[model samples]
Target: MKNNRLYAQFSTGYRAPQTTELFRLQAGQTIAELDAENINSIELGLRGQVESLFYDVTLFSMHKDNFIFQDTNRQNISNGETSHRGIELAINYQWQYFYVAANGTFAKHRYDTNLTLSRINIQDNEIDTAPEHIGSVQLGLRSDLGEFVELEWVHQGNCYINPENSSEYSGHNLLNLRTGIRLSERLDIGIRVSNLTDEDYAERDDFGFGSYRYFVGEPRTVYATVQYQY
Candidate 1:
């Protein structure tokens, strides 16, 4: 227990209706007449160090009332209840000239009560656009001369695209590389390459108006930067 710490937290949140949520017209309705959202959350965490390796892990749960969401008709409405629960982890290790760091999250966002979104019954359905798994890991090498190189991999899990849970977006994984070195105390140069594999994927996906839409992700690209500090 000497090298570890445990902690817990409780929090509450409130959010008033946004301008669009309050005034946006839907079908024959003129005003939203929406109520504010209330949220309650609890979290527990543990962090510690084992020699040169460090780790932190956390678990969290949250409940919301009057949760607002846009329905199939593009009208904002409030639901009776929603719940979110998740776990997060982060770890890092460094030895001499090499180091590795990683972090990840797994969560579920769901409707807690039966609700109707434009004639569709949604109960215990995952929230649209809310991915259940997301994570990134990085490996790097560095020297005393300020030279370093890092490679990272990022991942996203699939999720529903509609409140009805009838459609989903199959997630994506990406690779990125970065390298840099100090030319002098005040001068530095670096280069970065994103989407290294040029994998075809969508950064975002949605379903609306009886159609599926995608925002395409960028292709493999390289860029450089030079920095001078006064």
Candidate 2:
């Protein structure tokens, strides 16, 4: 047997348009009822070491759909769902006083609005933060000086940002760095720096004729951490 509940909410200052599919001054009201039961997740992968290097790889896929959204202005109530199919890779290597690790993700996301939504190809962006390409790499070493540390890095560029490729937004290559020392095998400390060059970027772009000014992610940040694991 299955049971379900339904609810509707209007914001303190939100009102939906009267009888509309989309494209109104006021967002539309949504009536939603769902049925769910017995859901679970599973992963499959392999791990092994070759010579002096270690490798782990995973291929996985998941899908979701059946959702709805209504804007306060009622002109942008759009609903859609998409899926992600991709692989995760990891590799580690060690050489006298030097260590390196690398990882990456290759995935594809596709979304279609339930009501043929459109605005610079936003109907396709509904998948939410699903980048077509993603990757990262890291390197570290205990310098011969025992104090001077050099960091190196590289990663794949994000391929998708906001449904369409050319919609006032572009993908970017992110960089990171970190270095520190080990007070002891039981306790170690380090710092990580991101966006080394301080590039101006946005994960989401707003284009509504200056109704409001939006903010994106951070420009740069440095953090230090000390930890002990049993």
Candidate 3:
């Protein structure tokens, strides 16, 4: 699914705790009022498939009067943001013995931030880790070993940080294996492994960026399970 140049406008109001003393957020804080207004937004989408296995995509967008950064402690700063235009895609195939799939994301998200402070005003540009392009694929094969077994590979494209767009982040290629057996009537057992290759990669940047950056990913591991039903 996709969207384009859609705008959202809204207003909200709130009341602070009634206090005998002036509303004190910090030792020396200064905020205007408890009401907000004129917040705006927009979006766009482009996607399609080919031969029922291949795919294509694109995304364009812009927004104004948005404020996710106003959560700062300044108490007197209001900011708005927007996103850069981009695209993404994927492909896949499946057979009795072998199956594969691939996909990617391409987008440049940015925002304008401003703070209202006396002699300490601030404004800046922030580039998104969405990256102008993102891509990855997966391949899997099935086999017999007294039971049905399978192993698969997965990979992703790189990401980024900072408005200047530097230090292109690295992606991780992961592999997994699984096997199962019929233990008895309505009973089954299975074994599996994650991150089979144990490839070292950072799913996110040290600082907040893109979706869930700054979060460390997991390493390789193994597990076993059994299930019974009547």
Candidate 4:
């Protein structure tokens, strides 16, 4: 492993179906029985610092059974099964007063079985909110005088909006700027301006009530903060 660290891990997880999801009777539909979902996962990772650069990489896979999800018909269902596999990477470097940091993830989350929904068998479809790619990069200036300024770019790849894979939320990218200064050993101040480009986007999207709707993402905004450490 030299100057790096390598590790492997296995874990199990469980989640009970939400009470509201299970008992919220809609119209004339009867409440259906639901079961807790379970997952088994394995992960392998390597982390280390090489000179001024620091990096960590990880690969992971998970198998989930009786996965609970909301259906297109607005009913909660425990589908057959699903699998998720992914890789994540992070790196940071500093050269004098200038530095950069970046991280990214690429993954696939898909059905591992033919799930019967509304008299249809759907298999190998991507899940909602599970984009195939997501990443962020930040470049900054820092000094011994306790001052720093940074700009960051964030990105998300296109993702399906429902289990039927009928629609997509065509991804988005955002820019943000931040700066801070230390007034004293125990006092500091900072300002952040997010969505620097004022791009229009949506945090979530879905088809409901025979129409498409979205929760609009936040627009360009600014704020300041002050901190006093005891």
Candidate 5:
């Protein structure tokens, strides 16, 4: 308990209907009828340091009333209720010339009450495109000469692609590499390679109108940057 801390929090949130949701007319309608969204949340957390290692963890739950969303017809509507719950973790460690850090979230986003959308019943169903797992880890090394390099791995877990929960998108993983050096007292140089493995995956996926659609992720790419302080 010497280097540890525990905390708890409760919060509330509110969001008024957006102009598009209020002003956009649906077929044969002058204006869409929508209500503002309100949410209540609770969270518990712990953080501490053990020697050279530091870590933090949290658990959270949130509930919302009148959750606003667009139906398959692209018309704005409000769901009666929705719930979100999750756990998150972060850790870091360092020793001499090397260091590592990682963070992640595991969560569920669900409709809490039975509702009809686009002629479909969605009750206690996971929200479409809401991945349950997402996280990244990074390892790096540095020297007293102001040079450093890092390698990172990113991950996304699978999720439903449609409100029906019948279609899913198998998630993806990617690797990235970056290095930088202080070129001079006023300058710095850096290079980065994203999607290092050139993996093929979709940045986004959707199922609609009897079809599955995808927005492809970027291929491996390299970037260079030089910064000068004025």
Candidate 6:
């Protein structure tokens, strides 16, 4: 089409502190009435198609003020400022009944103002709970018999667990499979297997109260679902 296009956008935004941030009660903790966070963002994006292949990509940047974060003491606090940027890409190709698709994001979140946690200056450090990379890929077949099957791979990059960047949670890769069939004009059924390799990984980790802890990810599991339309 002659109208295929690329675009760029700029915007400013802000977020008021959430209820949890304003009123979470716990022993040894004090809640503060916090200011809303603000940000200025810019984005560039493209969408186009060539033959049987289609793709989209976006690049974006954000300058944030009063970024809400949890400190080493597990208290919700506003950080001075931060710079966030990322690239996101997605592509899909199809030839007849067979197709493949992938999408991913690579990002960076860094402190723009110096922070003192545990008596350490953490200016320009990677923020906790921020993964540098995350993505997924899939291959699948679609048939006229009202059925489809797909295999997928998912990934997450490592990230720090503390504002000081002293603790880490390693990255992980996982495999999954899904298949579905139409049982009738009004019914469908499906089956899924997640973490096909039964890989061991930590979903999250943190240091609190002078101790380090983690939540383990789920192991290999299978499940089924049925859907009926009225």
Model 6 clashing residue pairs (backbone): none
Encode model 1's per-residue lDDT on 2-116: one tens digit a residue. 9999999999989999987888678866678788999999999999999999999999999999988776567778866999999999999999999999999999999897766
TM-score of each: 0.94, 0.60, 0.58, 0.89, 0.94, 0.88
lDDT of 2: 0.54
lDDT of 5 by residue, 42-88 (tens): 99999999999999999999999998876666677886698999999
Minimum summed lDDT over a 10-residue window in model 1 is located at: 113-122
Model 6 ranges with Cα > 4 A deviation: 1-3, 23-33, 70-79
Better by TM-score, candidate 4 or 3: 4
* Candidate 4 clash pair list: none
lDDT, residue 195, candidate 2: 78
lDDT of 2 by residue, 1-230 (tens): 02222222222222233343332334233443322211122346777776678887776665444434433343333244545567778888988888788888877666644334334455545343455566767777776645335465544445433334443334566677777776766777778887777767665544343232235657888887887767
Which prediction has more favorable TM-score, 2 or 5? 5
> What would the TM-score be for candidate 6 when compared with the true structure?
0.88
What lDDT, from 0 to 1, does candidate 5 have?
0.91
Candidate 4 residues 1-230, lDDT tens each?
57799989999999998888688855655875678899999999999999999999999999999877655566677866999999999999999999999999999998887775424556888876689999999999998987999999999889987667888999999999999999999999999999999999988787657667888989999999999999
State in Å the error of residue 159, model 6. Answer: 1.3
The TM-score between candidate 1 and the true structure equals 0.94
| lDDT per residue (tens digit) for residues 88-168 in model 3 | 455666666676777766665555554332123234434535545555566666554345666766665565554344456
Q: Return the lDDT, model 5, position 61.
A: 99
Instruction: Please rank every candidate by TM-score, starting with the best.
Output: 1, 5, 4, 6, 2, 3
What shift in Å separates residue 91 of candidate 2 from its native position after superposition? Answer: 1.0
